[model samples]
Target chain A: MERTTFNALDPNSNVGCGRGSGVEQGAEETIFTEQASDDHVIIKDSCDVTVTTTDIQAAVNLQVAIQLAIALVLSVSIADGSQAQKIQQDLLQRISTKQLIRQKTYIENSRGIEVTMTDAEASVSIQLLLQVLLALVAKLDVL
Target chain B: MNESDQLANKLGELLLGDVLERNGFTPSSKRPLTPEQKQQIRTVLENLQVETERFLQHSQRTIRRESKPNH
Candidate 1:
């Protein structure tokens, strides 16, 4: 059995991103992770597991990034633009795609149950926010 | 119908209904939209497409950042 440790995390390492263009840091970006995990991944499976330290970080980073991006869009002056209605519909379409495919998540091996649970909760919150935004947009879409 | 199309249609209908009611029209009235009204709808569609593309890019970037390993 491989031993796992958490002393390799580099908050500045950039994870899987290679000098990525530019990371616009928003408050929400750091809301999930104040510090990156220095954890060394060691999976017990005979086969190599896909979830690594970077994967876990990326997952956390992605969720926050998406949250911030949506928030930014919603906070802009065009918050209630007529197009919002269509955009909301498009978002619904995108969210629905989750039901069409089954993804074998590595969360079980890469992260703890708490992180997985948090992700689920975040997903539900995001969906609810989208739905509420769309409802508001529908009411205002008319000229 | 595909889920995406169904969702798009449903949202479109809600928005369209509001627009029509405000303009003194109804879905069952079978009245054609004026040119200006049509233009407004087109503008909204275009804007949505642009924003959708941008959001997709953000998502792609996130995936790229997460998928590659530093080692």
Candidate 2:
């Protein structure tokens, strides 16, 4: 009878290539090192201001539109007695609510970003709103 | 906060103050203004006040012109 014995040092042995081994260690080291260097610090001196004139312009325009609509409604209601009081009250409440909303939005927007305004544009919008308000008030007075 | 920031803050407070005053905002209101917040309000109010004056003047002119008799 001939006896065959298993040798651990065989080149083709599967025992040495078991589940967890040093080969994976090299790969893990490389991966860990790569990951460690991936996160880079970015230093910034000044942040970019993102708020545009367009935003303010659009908001002002919308306000003007609302004012015009209110004026129109006031004009129609004031022509009739009972409706005048109701319209005036409704308009006042609506304006107060809108002003509150505007204040909130303005603060929120201004908090993070820098807003640049030109004197000309600001003056224009102010003029527009004042005119609309005056017109509406005049109509209300007549009523 | 640098000097520029401080100045800006002051301007903002002034504007906010104007707005609050114009809108009948009281310190006892639900939305109380902090010192910093007041500065912001003041800035907005200042800007708005300028615009409001301009608008009122323009409107007055328009009304006057409209009320004029046709030659």
Q: How close is candidate 2 to the true structure, as a TM-score?
A: 0.22
Over 4 Å off, model 1: A1-6, A9-143, B11-41, B57-60, B63-71
All candidates: DockQ: 0.11, 0.03
Query: Please, what are the lDDT tens digits per residue for candidate 1 over residues B1-71?
Result: 55643565566456435543554433233323456754654464445445433433342221211222334
Q: What is the lDDT for B51 in model 2?
A: 53
- What's the count of clashing pairs in each model shown? 5, 19
C-alpha local distance difference test of each model: 0.34, 0.35
Q: How far is candidate 1 from the true structure (C-alpha RMSD, Å)?
A: 14.8
Best by DockQ: 1
